[model samples]
Target: MRRFLSLLVFLGLALAQGLSEVWKAVEVPGGICADGSPYRFYVSPGDPRRVVLDFQGGGACWDAATCSPESPTYRRRVEVQELLLAQGIYDRLSAANPFQGWTHIFVPYCTGDLHVGRATVDYGGFRVHHQGARNALAALEYLFRNHANPERVFVTGCSAGAYGAVFWADRVLATYRNAQVALCGDAGVGVRTEDFPGFRVWNPRLPELPGLSPDPEVYQVYLALSRAYPQGRFAQYTTLLDGTQVFFYGLMRGERLPSEATARAWAESALRAVTAPAQAENYTFYLAPGSQHCILPRPELYTLRVGEVAFLDWLRALAEGKTPPRVRP
Candidate 1:
C-alpha cells in the first residue's frame, strides 16, 4: 500500500508540474520522437512554447550517460541536477551561497552525455556534433507533422544538458529552420567563484572545495562523438571556458589544446550538407568570463526568475531565419 501510494503521489506531482502531461488539452502521449528513439518530450501546459525533451534523466532515452550517478563528476557534467538538489548534501551547498544557486542547475545543461539508440540513427554514444543534427532533424520533422508552428522552442538542461545544447549548435548548422539552441554555461567557463581561465584560473582568496575535480574521461565520450562528425554545425561557439574552476572541463593549453580548441574552432569545422556558402550570420557565440562551466554566463543580462521571456527573443529570431543578435556582456 505504501508503494502504491508513493506511485500515486509521484503521478500526481508529474501531472501538476506538467512533467507528464498538459492541462486543458488532450494529453497526447509523446512517443519516442516519431524517429523512433526511446526519448520523452514534455510540452509544458504553463507554456507550450517551451518543449523540454526531459533529457539527462527526465527523459526515457536509453542513453544513460546523458545523466549521471551520485558523483560530483556528473553534477559538473550535464545531468538533471534538480534531482541532486533534492538531496540533503546539495541543500547544504545551496545554503552556503544561494546567489550562485543556478550553477547547480546550469552545469548539466552543458556537458551531459549524448547517447541515442534504436532504428533510423544509432551512433552508440552521444555526440553533440552528430546528436545536434539528429535532434534538429527530429525537431523539424516533429514541428511539421505536429504543425506546432510554435513561437519559440528552447532546449535546456544542467551540466550535461547545457553541453548538449552547445554541442548541438556547434555541430548542427543553419541553426535549424525554426529553432536556436542555447547552451547555458555552454562550456562552464567562469562558473566557479574561485577560478578564472587565461589570465588566472583559480580563486586564491577561497580555498579549493574538497572532493571537486575535473572528469577528463567525459572528454572521451565527446571525442568519440566529434570523431564521427568531421564537419560541425554552428559558425561559432559559446563555451563556458571561464577559469574559475577546472573541475569537469578546462583550457586547451599546449598539446592538450586541440580538444579545448574544438569549442571555439567549431566555426571552421565542416557540416553534413554540401554546397554551403559562408554562414557567419547564422549564429552567435557568448562566453562567461570567470566560470569553468555554464553556471553563470551573463547574470546581469539574463533574469533567473523571469522564466523564458529573455530567451524567447533569440528563439524567435533563429526560427524566422534572422540572425539572433549577439549577447556581449
Candidate 2:
C-alpha cells in the first residue's frame, strides 16, 4: 500500500510537470526504416528558445551478414515505447540533466547506415532500405520549419547515433545560424578497415566538404565540421575499451567475433579518431576507462566521472559554450 501511494505521488508530479503531454510524433513520408516501415520522430515541448536534437543509437550494419534481421548488431525498427520511457538525459525529473526543460527532438535510428545512407540495397533476396540520410534530413527539415530560431541547440547521439550527430551538426547549425550550437558525439567512432571498404555499400550522401580526403573517416567529418563551423562547440565521449565499437571494428574487418587483437586495434583507431581534431580549439574529448559503448542516454550521464571532472559537468560545460578540458583516464 505504501509503494502504491508513492507511485501515485510520482504520477501526480509527472502529470503536473506535463513533459509527457507535449511529446508530438511527427512522421515524414520520405523517411523510412530498414524494413521499409514508416519512420517517425518525437518532439516534446519545453523552453522553445533552447533545443536538443538527440539521435537514438541501436548499432549499424554494413554488409549482408550484419544487416540480417537475425543479426544482433543492429536494430531494424524504431521502438516508440522505449523512447517515450527513456531515462537519463530524457528524464525530466533529474535536475542534474543539462538538457532539462529544453525542447527535445528525438531522431530514431533504424536504417543501419549511421544516419547517412540514401539507398536501397539487395542482400540475397532481401531488400533493405538504407535511407538514413533521408530520414535524418526529414527530421531536420521539421526542426528548420518549427524551431527556426533558438538561443541554443545541442546536437548529440550515442553509438551509431554519435556518427549521426557528427554528420548532421553542420546542417543543424546552418538552419539555426544565429543559435549557439554544440555537438557531443557519444561513442560511435568511425574506424573502418581499409582493405574491406564494405561501408561503401551504404552509398552515403556525404556532405561536400572541401579538402576532405577522397575517402574520409568519421573523424574527418568531425574535423571538417569543426573547421566549417568555427563558432560551434564540439566534443566526443568514449570508453577506453568500448566493447560495441570493438565488435563493429571486427565486423568491418570480417571477424564476426572480435579477437583480443581486434580490441587493441579498435582502441588505437578510436583514440586516433578522437584526437585527430584536438587541434581545433573549439573541440575537446572525454575519455573514460571502461568497455561501455555509450553514455549520454544512460544513468552514467550524471554519475560517471574521470578523475576530478564528472562527465555530467563536462557535458554541461560543452552545452553552455564553455571549454571543458580534454579528460583522459
lDDT scores of the candidates, listed in order = 0.30, 0.84
The TM-scores of all predictions, comma-separated, are 0.37, 0.91
Candidate 2 lowest-lDDT run of ten:
79-88
Which runs of model 1 end up more than 4 angstroms from their true locations?
Answer: 1-39, 46-71, 75-112, 115-144, 148-158, 166-185, 188-245, 250-279, 295-329
223-258 in candidate 2: lDDT tens per residue? 888888888898998999999889888887778799
Output the worst ten-in-a-row residue range by lDDT, candidate 1.
Answer: 198-207
> Which stretches of model 2 miss by more than 4 angstroms?
1-22, 81-85, 196-198
Error of 1 at 280 (Å): 1.3
lDDT (C-alpha) at residue 30 in model 2: 68
The TM-score between candidate 1 and the true structure equals 0.37
